[model samples]
Target: MTRMPRRSVALAAAVAVLATACSAGGGAPKPKQIATGYTATPQQTGAPKDGGTITVALTPGLSPNYIYPYPPAAANGTVIGRGQMWRSLYRPSGEGDQVADAELSLAEPPAFSPDRKTVTIKMKDYKWSTGTPVTADDVVFSLALLKAALKESPANWSFYTPGQFPDGVSAEATAPDTLTLKLETAYNPSYLLSMLTLLYVMPSAEWNIAETGGEHLDFKDPKNAKAIYNYLTEQSAEQSTFATNPLWQVVNGPYKLKSFDPTTGSFSLVPNENYSGPGDSRLDQVDFKAFTSAAAVLNQFKAGTLTVGTLDSSYVTQIDELKAKGYSVYGAPAPARFDALTINFANTVDNFDKVIAQPYVRQALQRLIDQNGYIASRGIYNGAGSPNYSTAGSGSPYPPAFGDTPPYPYDPAAAEKLLTGNGWKVVPNGVTTCENPGTGAGQCGAGIEKGQKISFTLASANTPAYVGARDVAFSSAAKKLGIEVKIVTKALNYMYANYGNTFAPATKNEWAMQDFGPLYLAAGYPSSNTVFNADGSFNLGSYRNAEVDKLINESTFGADEKTLSAEVTRLAEDLPVLFFPTPHTLVVVKDTLSGPQSSFNALLSYLYSPEQWYFHS
Candidate 1:
C-alpha cells in the first residue's frame, strides 16, 4: 500500500486569494473596505433548492475559440464552460476557505513512488455522458496529445520545456483503471501535484483520430505533430453549436451545453443527468449573457435580471445602491494577481536603461508611490485591497514570513534626497538632470551621462475608470521628485501586445512602464521561475539579476517552504517591478442563489462552483 505524502495533503492550501456584498440608498453609503488577505466565503442567505435558471453576466464577450480548456488562448468563458462538461482529476472542494482542499473529481489522489520519480493515478468508476467509462487509457491518450500540442503552443505546456515530453516524462496504463507517469527529473512533489491541477482529461476515443494506418505517430515528428495539433485545435474551434456536436455532447461533468450564440456571447447549460461527479447540480438551467460594460452588468443586477455579476473599483461607491436593490455583494483580494508599474530594463532610449537599473532610483520611485492613497481614490470596496511589495503579490500560498516588508515609505522628501544625493540635481515637480556622471559617490550611476533627465512614458489599459486616476496620482507623485512621467492610455489589447513583447535591439522603445494586473496566475504555483527568471518567457521588462535567477530556478524544484520563502524575500527587496495595491474582486449575487463559492482558479469571478448553486425558493 502506498502512503499519501504530507506534501500532497498540504496541497489543500492551494486556494489563492480571489472574492463580494450590498447596501441601501442615501447616496449609496461608502462601501465597506476589507483589508488584503481576506478569504471570501460563499454567500449564505437560504438553503439550497433545486430546479431554477441562474443568469450570469459576463463582460467583453465569450471566447470565440471553442471551449477547449488545454489551449493557452482559451477564453475565460471557455474555461468556465469547459469546466461544466470536462472533469479534471481533482476539483476544489467548495468550502469557502482561503486555502481550498482538492477533492477527487474523476480520479483519486495519486500515489507516488519512493524515489518520487513516478505518479500512479487511479481512475474513479465514472462514465461520460455517452455511456462510455472513463478509463486509464483515456488519461494516457490525453497526456500524449497534450505533449504533441506543446510544440505548436509552448504557453499551453509552460510547465515543461521543449522536447521534454516522451523522454523526460512519459505516461502509460498499467491497469484498466490505473495510469502511471514517470518523470526523468525529480521535482518537488507538491509542485508536481499543483501542476497536475491544470491537466484536464479528454476522451481518447473521440480525440485520437490523428493516429492513422495503425502506426504510432510520434509528436516529435514536425510534420505529423503539426498535422495532429491543427486537427485537434480546429475541432475545438468548430464546435459552434453545442447541441449538434457529438463530441461535446459526451461530457463527464455536471452540465452540458444546451445552446450557444456566438454573436451575442450568450449560452445556456442544462444539467447532465449521467455525470458521475461527487454532487448533483441543483440548477435546472444556467445562462451566460454578455454585457458591454461594468455599468451594464450593474444595471442588470439592479433590475434583478442577472443572478451573478462582477463590480469593478468604479462601482465600489454604488455598493449601497446594489444593496438597496437587494443584491448581496462579496469582496476579497486577488491571490495570484496584482497591478504594478513594470519598467523596461532593456529600453535604451533616453538613457532609460541607465536610470532604471539603479537600485536607489527604483527605491526612490517606490517611495513616491502612495499605494494606500491610490486605493482610497478608487473607493475600492471592502478595504478589498492592499499594497503588493513583491512579485508574489497578496494571498500567495507561501507563508507571510517569506514576503517582503515595505522598505520605502511614501515620502517625496526622502525620494528627492535619494536622487539629489546621487549627484542628480533636484527640480521639484519638474524633470531632474544628472549633474555628475561617474561611479564614485554623489555621482549618477554608471552608463548615465551628465545632463540625462529623469523621464519616461507610462502606458495603461483604457478601461477601468480607476486606472486614469491611478496614472494621475503616479504622475503627480513623480513630479514632486523632479521626474517627468508621461501617461498614455490605450486599448487593453494594444497595451498588452506592446508591454508583453520581448525587447529587441531593432524594435523601438514604446513605453518605459506599464500598469496592469494581477500579473501572474496562481496555477503556476506562485514561484518566480516563470515570471521573474532572467530568461523567463513572460519577463516583459527584460529585468535580469543572476542572484534572482538562481533563487527562482531553485524554488521551482525545491520541496521545502523555506527555500521558496527565501526567494520571495529576496524579490521583495530587489524590486524588479514596482509594487501597487492589489485589486479586490467584488462579486454581486442575487439573494436567491446559494453555494456560490470562490476558487483560486477563477480569481476575477464567482463561477467556480456553478453546479452547487441553486435558487432559494
Candidate 2:
C-alpha cells in the first residue's frame, strides 16, 4: 500500500499525450493476450501513434551485463527470466508458458533443418532508432564475439559456452536480411531459438573492432578490440550504466532504444516505423523510471503516476490491499531462477566417495524435504511450481515435459532407510555415522575422530525469496539427517564473490553449499563442465563427479536431445546441487500494460515493441 508521487503521475500523463500524438496514422496492434486486470478499449487504427517515452522501474538495479541476449549469461539470464526483456522470436502469450509460432518482431517464423541441426533467421525490416538496417552481419559478429570470449577469457565466459557453435557450425550472412547458423550436429533446435530470441542484434559495424586482435584489441584504444569489449563489459548491470548508441541499428524487433541516461537512471523507447507486423502502436511512448525502494514503486502505482512496476517480497502479503484500492494486480509465475542450494562439494569432508556417491543417498536427500509447503508458506507468486532434479527434471527426465514419475518425493523415512541401507548407522540423537568400510573401529561413525561432521554454512543473498526459502527448507531438511546447517546472508556483491575467477580457496572451504541460478541455457540443456570442472571458474560448490562431469561434456556436443537426455538422466541420478523447483518467471504488470505475457526468452522483444501496447483513453 504505497502511493504514487505527484511528479510521477504528471510525468505519466505527459507520456500519454506523447503516445497519442505519436500514434497518428500508425495504429497500435491488438496483441493476442490482453492485460490481466486493467481493461482498456483498443486504440483505433491511425489513432494512438507510436512515439513518446514510457517510464518503467527495473529491479534492484540495471547491470550492463543485460547485453547477453537469448542464451543469457548467468546474470543477464536472471533479468530476462524476470520478464524485463521481451522476446522477438519465440514469445509466449503470458509468463513462461508454451511458445507462440511467430511474433510481431520476427520477419518470418523460425525454420529448422530436417535433422534439426541448423536454424535460419530471416530479419524483419525493423530499424533501430538511429535508422540503420539490422543485418545478419550483426548476428554473426555477436556469436563470434561470444565464441572468442569463451576461448580467451574463460573466467569471464564461465556462465556460458561456445559449444552452441560446434566444430562444423558457423554463422554467415546468407542474405542482407537473413542469418543462417549451420550446426555441427542435430540437437534441440529450441536451444538456438532461445538464445537468438533475447540476443540484441548489435550493428556489426560498431563491434567489428573487437574481432581484430593485437593493435585493435586494446581496451583504451577507441578503435581496438579492447574498446569494443570494454563497451559491452562496462555496460554490464554491475556498472548500472544504461547507455545506448544512437548510431546502433536494430532490424529484428519492434521498438528501438530511444534515450538512455545513466545519470538520471531513466530510459525511453520508441516504436519502429518500418516494422512489418499485424496490429501495432497503442501507446505513443514508454518512460522507464528507476526507484531504489519497492515502497517507492508501490506508492507511484497507487498514486496513478506509473502504470507498470513489480511488487517486491515485502509487498507480496499486501496483494489484497492493492486490489481493494482499485489496482489491477496480475500475478504470473517466475522461473526457478535462484531457488537452489549449490554445495561446493569440492571442499566438503562428507564422504563424497562412500556417502554422496550413492545414488539413493542423493535421492533420499532430495526427498527428505517438502517443497510444496515451503512454497506455500512463502506465497510463491504463481501456483506453477515443480520439484526439480539436479538436471531440471521434475517429472520427466526433461523439463516442461512434466514426466510421469516425480523424481524425488519428500520422505524422511525413505531417506533414513536409504542411508542405513547404504552402510550408515543411526546414533542415539538422530545423528548418523558410517564406518570407513576399509578402516578399523576408530576410523568412522559418531563419537569417533575417524569421521568429520557433515555440516557447513550456506551463503546466499539477503533477498527474501533466497534467504527465506533456502534457510527454512534446507536447514529443516538437513537437520533431520543430523547435519547442522548454518545460513549466511550477504549483500549481492559479497554473495556472488566467487562468480568467476575471484574465489579464495579458504572461502571456498568454509562454505559447503551456496545458492545459484543457471545462466540462461540456449536449448535449456544442463552442462556443468564449465561450471563444475575441478578447477573451472564457476565450480563454486566444488562438487565434482567424474561421472557427472563426463555426462555434461557428452551432452554439450551430443548429436541430439535423446543422446543428451541419456547423459542428463545419468547426472540427475547423481544429484549435485539439490535442484528443487525450476519455476517459470512471474511478471506482475498493471492492467493498463497491454501485450503478450511472455515465454522462456521473448521478454526483451516484448519491451522493444511496447508501443504496440494499447491503452484506453
Candidate 3:
C-alpha cells in the first residue's frame, strides 16, 4: 500500500480496485491505437462546456462491504467503492497514471517533511452540502474512527486493517483547513501516504457527539461498545439519507448527490455551482444503472442505450466484430494479477500431508500450466505484453520495472523431475503416487481417496473467464501433466462469497484447487493474514504454513522496500498459490471521452472521475 503523493507516488492503490488494472510496481505503458481501424487522437484540453448529463450502466456489486470508521463498519478501505459518492483530497490524473493537481477538493497542496516522513494536508475552504466548512476535526475523527473500529472489530480486521498511518502517528490541526500528520519512521511512506487518498473525510460535528462524555466507548465495555457499533452501522447504512442534514457539510467536488432511487437502482448528482474547480460541472443529470446480467448490458450497448461494458477475453471476439461495425473498442493490458492455485497444506487431505507440504508440488503445478498460451487464448496480451508472475509484473506492467527478468519459465520436463525426486514415483497409468502400501482409512497422493490419481477442482468464474475458452485452455494444459481437474463454475458473486472463505459443511465436498484471483488490498504484495493465517477468515483451504505466515505478517507491520519486494517474490516463487496471467482491461467509450486512462498496477473503478468527464458535443 504505497502512499501516493500529490505528484510523486504512482496510482498503484487506485488501480487495484479494478480487476484489469492490477500492476506490479511501475505504471503501465501509455494507451496507443490498437489498429481497430480507428486512430485515437488525444482530445483537446480546457474545453469545458458542462451541461449534458452522462448516463453509465455499471456492473452490479460496486458497493463495498463497509463504510465509516467504526467497529464492523470501519477500516474496510474497500469502502473506496463508495468513491463514486464521495471525493478524496487527491485524485488520479485523467491519464490514470498518477495523482495530478488537486481540483476543488484540497484548499492547498499537501506539505511533506523534508525527509517525507510527515505530511501536512490543509482542507480546502469547502463545505458539505449543509454549508459548514470542512475542518481538521473531520480528518481526526475519520482516523480515530478507523483506529477504534480496527481495535474493536476482530471479524472485520481479520485481514490487515486499513488506514494504518505509521508506527508512531499523530494528527493535529494548525488552522481551520490545515491538518498535519507526523510519522515515526519513514521508508517509501507511499503505502501509508496513498491511504490518505482513500480516506473519506467525516463531519466533525457528528463525531463530537459520538465521542462525548470523557466516557469513551471501549471494546471491553459491553454496553458502550454495542451502542457505539450500532450508531456507526446505522450511519454507514444511511450516508445518502443524511446527505442533506443542515449539520452536514459537503466538500467542493464536481458533483453532489441530488437524489437516489435505490429501488430503481438510479442515483442523480447535481453539480456544485457554488464551488470553482478545474473542470466545469455541466452534466445536468447523472444516472447510474446496475445490470443483472452481462448480456443485458451488451444488449443495451447493442441498442445504443448503454455507455459502458466491462470487456474481457470472452467479449474480445465480439468486440472485434463490433469494431468492424465502426464501434470504437479500446483495450489496455492489465498488470499481471497472479491468479494462483493455493494449497491448504495445513488441512490434511489424507495421509499425504508430507507429500503435499513439499514445495515441489507447488512448483510442479506452476510449470504444468503454460501462461503464454493461456494469455494468448484469453486475449490478455493483445497489444504488447509478456507473461508476468506479479501483479505489477517484474516492475510496472506498462512502463514495466527497469532491468528485471522474468521468473519461473514454463518447464514441464523439470516439473516431472522435481516431483519424481520428491519420492512420488510416476506409475505407468500416468498416475503418480507416493511410495506407500496402505494408510489408516483414507489414502495418499494427489487423487481423491487414493494416491493413484492426480485430481483437483478448479473453482472459477461462471462467466467467460472460467466457463468459456480460458477454462478450456487452462484445463487442457493441466491435463498434459497427467492431472485430472474438474472445472467448477460458480456465479461470480457466489464465487467471491464461498471461495473468499472456506466452504461450509452443507456444500458437497468436491473442490480442491481454485484458479482464483488474489485478495489484494492497497498493500501491493500479498499477506497471509487474509488467506493464509491459520485463524484467518479467508483461509478457505485451511492453509497453515507457519513460515509463510510469519513472512507475510512481518511484511505488513512495516517491511523495508527490498524486504517487502523480496518477501512478495519469495512467496510467489514458493508457489503458495500457482500464479496465472491477469486479464487485460478493454473498454469501449464515446470518442469525446478524454482522460480515460486505465491502470495495470491497481484495481479499477467506474466512478474514478465521473465528475471530471465532460462531453465534446
Candidate 4:
C-alpha cells in the first residue's frame, strides 16, 4: 500500500494516554510512579452466548475515512481496515511484544536465509469469503500495489525510506502458498516482520483489474500494477461505495464492511463467514458509531447507547457513574507508543523555525512539561498519565536510561535560565524576546534576529481531552519563561490529515506545535526511520540530525541489535519532539460484552478483534 519513514505508523491511538516517570532532581530518584490502576486485559465475567451486534463508539472525529491500506498522511498516515475487512500478512502483537501474533497472523513466522537477504513466508490455512484460498498470489498482488503506490508518492506509505523495502527487493509467489522476497541487502528480522504487518492481502482474483469490471491482468507487469493501484485507490476514495461495492465484499478477515455513512464516517461490519482464522464470529454485527465531538460520545456513554468505547482521561472521574451503567472502566499506556507535542520546524511563524532550531530552545520547551503535575492535576490526566521520555514509551524492552529519567523534567526556573543564557531577555509575565542575534554559545542560534519572540501555536486535539488539558498546561508553563505558547484546539481527524508540514506544505505556518496523540511504530521493533530521518516521509517537523540518522541506519541495517535502543536514547536527549506523559486510555466496555483480552490492547495500533467478542450472561 502507501508507507512509514522506515517503519509503519497509523495516525490514531489518540486514545487517552498515561505513563511512568522519575523526578527531575539530582537526589535519590523519585519513586517511578506509573499508576497501575488500569489494566490492559481485565478479566471478563460471564459465559459466552452467540450473535449480538456490538455498537462500538469510534473515537470522536477519528472515524474511518480512507479505505486503502496505504494511508496518505500522518500515521504513515491512516490505514483504513486490517484485522477486519482485510488482514495484514503478519498480525501485530496485542501483547506488546516485538513479534507477530501466531494465531491471528495470515502467514507463519518469516524464515530468513543465512545471510538474512531473503525472507520466506508460508500462507496459513485461510480462505476468502469467495472460497478462494488466501495464497501467496494475494500477498504478491498486495506488495505490487504497494510498490506502485509508493512510486506515485512516498506519502502513500509513511514507513518507506527511498532506497529501502520494495525498492531493491524482488517479491514473488514461489509456490501457491509460499511468498519469498530476495532482498539486495540484509535486514533485521524484527524490522522486516514489522514492515510486513502493514501489507494487507487483498483478493487478487477480484481486485487485479485496472478498470471497473475490467479483465484481470498480470499484476507482475509494472504498468498493470500501476493501473491496479490507481483503480483501487480511486475506489477507496469513494467512501459511499465502501459497503455496496462487490469488489469490497470478498473478505478474508473476521468482519466485512456492511454499510458506511459517508457523513459522520460511521459504518457497519458483518461477520465474514469464510474467515479462516482462530475464533468464531460470535457477534452478529458491529456498528462503529462516529461522533462530531468527544462530548457527544460522552453523552452516548451516559445514555448507555455506547456498548464499548474509550473515555478520555478528562472523564475518568465519572468511572463510578459509568460503572453504575455496567461498563468496565480500564486504562493503561499503550505499548510501543509515546505521547508528545510534535514540534513543526518548518513553521516559520514568528521565527519559530529559527528559534526552535536551537538545541537550547527545544530543551527549554521540554523542561516546561510537568509530567508528574499532569498526573496529579485532575484537569488533565488526573493520575492516569505516566511520564514518558523516549519515543519507545513504557514497557518497551529497550528504553534508554532517559526513558524513565526525563532529560528535561518540569522546571520553570531552569527554562527561564536557558532562555537568558541563550541571549534572550526573559520576562516572567510578558513575552520573551531574543536579545542576542549571533550563532554563538551566548547568543540565540543562527538566523534568529534580536527582538524575535518565542511564540507559536500548540495545535492540540480536542477529543482525548488530555491533549487539550496538557497543551494548556504547557502553554501556561511557557508564559512563565516569556515564551508565547498559544493553544489551538482542533479535531483529531483534521489534525491527523492537515497538520503535517511534509504533506500539507500550504499550511506550514498554521501550527508550530501539534499534539495529535502518540505515533506507534512497527510492533516489537520501534525504529525511527520515517519519523526522524531527514528525508523521511513522516518526518512532519523536518527534524534533521546526522548522528541520529546514522543511529537509525545502524539499528535498521547494522548487526548490532542494541543500536536501536541507543538510537532511542539519543532521541530522548536530543528532543526531536517535546515528550509528554503517556496516559492510560480509559476504556468503558459494557461488562456484559466479553472477548479475548488481547483484542483491547492499545499498543497494537487500530486493530480490534470483535469476532472473538459476544454478549454473555
Instruction: Compare the candidates by TM-score and give the number of the best one.
Output: 4
Better of 2 and 4 by lDDT: 4
Best by lDDT: 4
Model 2 TM-score (2 dp): 0.71
Per-model TM values vs. the true structure:
0.85, 0.71, 0.73, 0.91
lDDT of 3 at 376: 44
Task: State how far residue 7 of model 3 sits from its true place (Å).
Answer: 33
Model 4 ranges with Cα > 4 A deviation: 1-40, 71-80, 602-605
Sort every candidate by lDDT, greatest first: 4, 1, 3, 2
lDDT of 4: 0.77
The 0-to-1 C-alpha lDDT of every candidate, in the order given, reads: 0.64, 0.47, 0.48, 0.77
Q: Model 1 — TM-score against the truth?
A: 0.85
> For residues 432-526, what per-residue lDDT tens digits would candidate 2 score against the true structure?
66634423332333232334444556665434242334354556567778766666654443455443222456665555665533232222433
Summed backbone clashes in each candidate are: 15, 81, 37, 31
